[model samples]
Target: MKYLVREKMFSIGDDFWIEDEHGNKAFYVDGKVLRLRETLVVQDPHGRELAVIHKKVISVRDAMTVERDGEVLVTVRKKLFTPFHDSYRAELASGDELEIRGDIIAKEYDIEYGDERLARISRKWFRLRDTYAIHVDRDDADPAMLIAIAVCVDRLVEHEHEKHEHEREQHER
Candidate 1:
């Protein structure tokens, strides 16, 4: 299944609906405000929360957790030593690791479990430039979980980008 995601989700309290390829609302991103840490809830059209994505402090590196019903489903952490392409690892609660790799800032990447590809996120399918697609290639895969993971990585990348920009501006000051 392929879902279309608009790139207008850059800030806290920004809410948006992600639609399927058929143009029907599939999931909603509810950004909760007035929280000490960033939190986002991925909900179904009927408003049932499926997963929660939020920032995790106290870690050596920045990390985010994807939770379901107060349980940690996956914790997304950046690989500290990537000198080439950007990457993140989704540590599943079931003790499996999903590798996220490729040009992340461009919204082009692949989520794979060792040898199998679970989903691919890219802007190559749409000409809108601001919209990207999440194509889940496996029937056994949980789409919401994958989507939440993507969001997790996105927030991390955006935070990193913001930090870099701040440092650059400070250097020039």
Candidate 2:
């Protein structure tokens, strides 16, 4: 199923509404305020938390963890020095590793487990800025997990771009 993730504007903390293809609000991503590190909680319409995503504090590479019920489901880390495209490595608690590759700047990417494509995230399908669609193969992946992964990936990519821009400004000064 494809869901639309629309980011909120003019908010101190990041907030998003995940909508179904019919434009019905399906899930809500609440970015916790006043945290040392970035953190977000995904909840159902009824307000029950489905998953929690937070940046890893002590990782050498940019990393984030997804958890449900205090159990880590997966850890996603950015792959440095990938040629031509952005890459990420995800380690699942089940010992299954996945690779994510695509144009992160354009928000077009796929999550793959070996040869199988588990999920696809893209903004090309929508005309609205800051809005993207996440398509998860329900037969191959859990929708909630994939959505959380997309959220983490989006934040990481944005953070990296900002970091680069800051460094560039420093160099120009």
Candidate 3:
């Protein structure tokens, strides 16, 4: 399945929708504002919450948590960065691990469990500059969970980008 996500859809308080390849609304992202930490709730069209993605305010490394039915589903955090690529680690509640590696700043990457690819996240397939598509490659993949993971990855990347920009400005001052 392919889901299209708007790149600018991460404004802390601004809401947006993830559309299917056929252009039908697939999921709604409700951005929560004025909170101590960033929070986004992914819901179905009928308004039932599917998953919640929120930042961990007290983590040593920048981290985000994904929850379903109010239970912690997984935690995603930056593992490291290289000149050519960036990496993130996802620890699932069931003791499984997933690794995300790629040119994340450019919105291109893959979510993998061991050697198997679960989903491919990319923007090159889209014509619109602000639109990117999340392609779930595995038939057993959970579309909503994968979408929430993509949302978390984007927010984490942006958070790091803004922090670095701020540091650069501080040195320039």
Return the top candidate by lDDT.
1
**Could you tell me every candidate's TM-score relative to the true structure?**
0.97, 0.92, 0.96
Ranking by lDDT: 1, 3, 2
Residue 21 Cα positional deviation in candidate 2, in Å, after optimal superposition: 0.5
lDDT by residue (tens digit), candidate 2, 61-98: 78999999999999988887887778987889999888
The lowest-lDDT stretch of 10 consecutive residues in candidate 2 is: 7-16
In model 1, what are the clashing residue pairs, if there are any? none
Best by TM-score: 1
lDDT of 1 by residue, 1-173 (tens): 99999877746899999999999999999999999899999999999999999999677889999999999999998987899988899999999999999999888899999989999999999889889999999999999999999888888988898999999999999
Candidate 2 global TM-score: 0.92
User: Cα lDDT for residue 163, model 1?
Assistant: 90
Candidate 3, TM-score vs. the true structure? Answer: 0.96
Local distance difference test scores for all models? 0.93, 0.84, 0.91
lDDT of 3 at 19: 90
Clash pairs, candidate 3, are none
Ranking by TM-score: 1, 3, 2
